[model samples]
Target: MDVAEGPSSSSVVSEQTIEAGHTLLLKMPTGDVRPHKIEKDTTVNLGKFGSFHANHLIGQPYGLTYDIVDKSLKVVPPRPIQEVEDTEATNELINDGEFVQPLTSEEIEELKKQGLPADEIVKRQIEQHANYQLKTEYSKEKYKKRKVAKYSKGFSTVIPALYNVCEYWFNKDATRLRDIRPDALSQILNLASIRPGGRYLCVDDASGIVVTGILQRLAGEGRLITICDIESPPAYPCMVQMNFPKEHTAVISSLNWATADEDYTPIVASSEPPTGKFKSEGQKSRLNKRKVASDMLMRHREELFAGEFDGLVIASQYDPWSILERLYPYLGGSASIVVHSPQVQILSDLHAKLRDLPGYLGPSLTEGFLRRYQVLPGRTHPTMNTSGTGGFILHAIKVYDDPNASSVMAHRQKAKKAKLEAEANANAAPATSSAEPERPVSDETLAETTQPIESSDAAMES
Candidate 1:
């Protein structure tokens, strides 16, 4: 199947065609979202909602709601009102103890077995409910919604943007993706300066989540070299679901962590090709596989050795410094390096180390706190039981050694020392009293002045 190429780096903000090989989030009638890869001519079973041919969804616009009607596909009409207004709120709620429906589970099963239409089945159940009249309009709407979620055979297709993909994994298996929330991932991407046509070296141990985020930002424009162990190749289930074209995915190259820096001495290139005379079929197949592995190793290792990648992004279990120390040399001058860890201490230690290093600048540690809210008009408030932290990130940039920087730094140190000394001197100096000093009269001047004042007083008395 010929999958369409994804939008360019600048054009992906808009919607595109839903083609085969594209990863899409299927929103079930019950509001459950599942990420699925669109393979051509495949059957997708939505369990109780029944199954549909994958081809039935091809060419449909994303966010289009589809319904399975009488074993055929149909587009669900858009609702006139997208949301229930706060004015529609009602106080009545059906108690869980109340089983208002007259139909038993067996009767519902019997109706389902008769191949009755889903809507017809739901309508029957609603009509049979004992509290059907007691329900307020809002309660009735809620009841119908609950029933539709169970009996409806429909789904909404959503374009799985990076945020959607992350949310899906977070809801499904957060531990698998290292709990790197979408907001945290965004910070990493922005701090790392991920851009189109830039080459990046990455350590993705978060089930390829980090890899996917980097790839999406690059938008099929640059090479993203990933470091992986031989035992576990960087296989992200999320990435497999994305419908990115072969060329876009080809930009993500992997190098074995152990042999990332090793010279690619191609043993396969030196070995003679297997001959029919000496090789059995099985042996020949093994030889071909070995050659393929060798070639792949050589290709990735050559790229690893090539001068300076644009950035380094690591999300791994190993010590961030250990990984950085090994890969730091390969980063270009002024390249952004971002390390993410769930534990704060690891990043704290890394920050202390990187900040003092000559080749790096401002290794600041930061974390993201996301608080979700129920955004209803009248009763909007923060959602209960929401996760507070995605993870912690350590962001820094690689720097080149500058001989003149030492002198500049020395000058700054001297200026700082002088300023400090000047402050100390000012503080140490004693305060002088501003009051007028008493003038001491000399003995002769004081006697003459007193004698004149006394003569003037005597004359005045006479």
Candidate 2:
């Protein structure tokens, strides 16, 4: 029989271009990123930067900067990041007053109304400034950057990768993601050992940010069984925002917490097909859809109950210990485990509890800290305002502990020693009439006698 093949690398690589209907992250001049869906022949409004036709960006590559002119976008070369040398200027005699610039707010607004470009407006402001000449090179560049951020009509198209998506949400509302920074999310993926073709069990309550990261890492080749509440569907808004391909999303299957019990049984759908035709095509289609959905749910439930998942990851609001206790049995031996929470106390408690568990190993609690910096010649320093804590993570591995392991090992050793002693006695003794009755050992008997004894406890643990 012929086997099926997965999608080619080229098909996945084609996503590098900005295509129609693909979700994109527009990074504005002020270091703000906004998500927008591209459509054919539509206008994308960029607020103060102005608006541009969506069709203009349909086939362009990402990471390219564009300038808005006449309500249209034009490709512009990216500015090179270089170090600025210090000049023989000091701020000792600089004035600290607000009226240092002759140009007023009304004049700037008039310049904008006259359709004058942002660069021209900034140039006029610099020319009108009373103390522009006395500023150092670094200070002058900083001033220009600030003015550009305020009035520049330029934006860059950012691909919706994991890091970019995390950054967008982190900047917009860190609370939504429980303050999971990009670095912290990356660390979680690494700690969990997320990879393609690995099965994982996840319980995410951070708007599916954790789930989304797993799916991206899986790359359309793994099973992700998400545990959720029975009352509602999984709230994975971040996953939806990612706009992943159908193959990537298909690997996700959800199991409710109530039904995850080993003793709990689901309501099985009838195996027999409908006997008669429906009154209308629409009715038949609806019935068929429901049947298909039911079948999928039953299959997913069976898979979950079968157990032996590769790893487990949890970022839920529920008690971490309780969640781990329930799902611990499903993981295979030596499987990686990771749990995340915004509060360090929660993970600290879980870490302590895991130490006492029989089938856990090396449980550790960690918190990630990230800081940004401004690099320039003789002017490099960490940014004044940086992200706080990205929350804490608890990572560990699962192992099997057999109750009868020691006893079984002892019994095997005793049997081997006794056999060795008997062989030594026989060699020491001379051949006698009683030995003459010993028949030649057949190949089957010899094989059985030489075969090593295996412990049932060890087999089950594996």
Best by TM-score: 2
lDDT scores in order: 0.75, 0.82
lDDT (tens digit, per residue) of candidate 1 on 89-189:
34455567685667787998888778776668779998888666665655666667687677777788877677777877777777777778889888888
Misplaced by over 4 Å in model 1 are 1-24, 35-42, 80-96, 99-103, 111-140, 231-233, 262-269, 272-296, 376-379, 403-462
Number of clashing pairs, model 2? 0
For every model shown, the clashing-pair count is 3, 0
Best by lDDT: 2
Model 1 TM-score on a 0 to 1 scale: 0.74
| Candidate 2 structure quality by residue, lDDT tens digits, 307-334 | 8999999988899888987899889999
Give the least accurate 10-residue stretch of model 2, judged by summed lDDT.
428-437
Model 2 ranges off by over 4 Å = 1-9, 98-100, 230-232, 267-283, 404-462
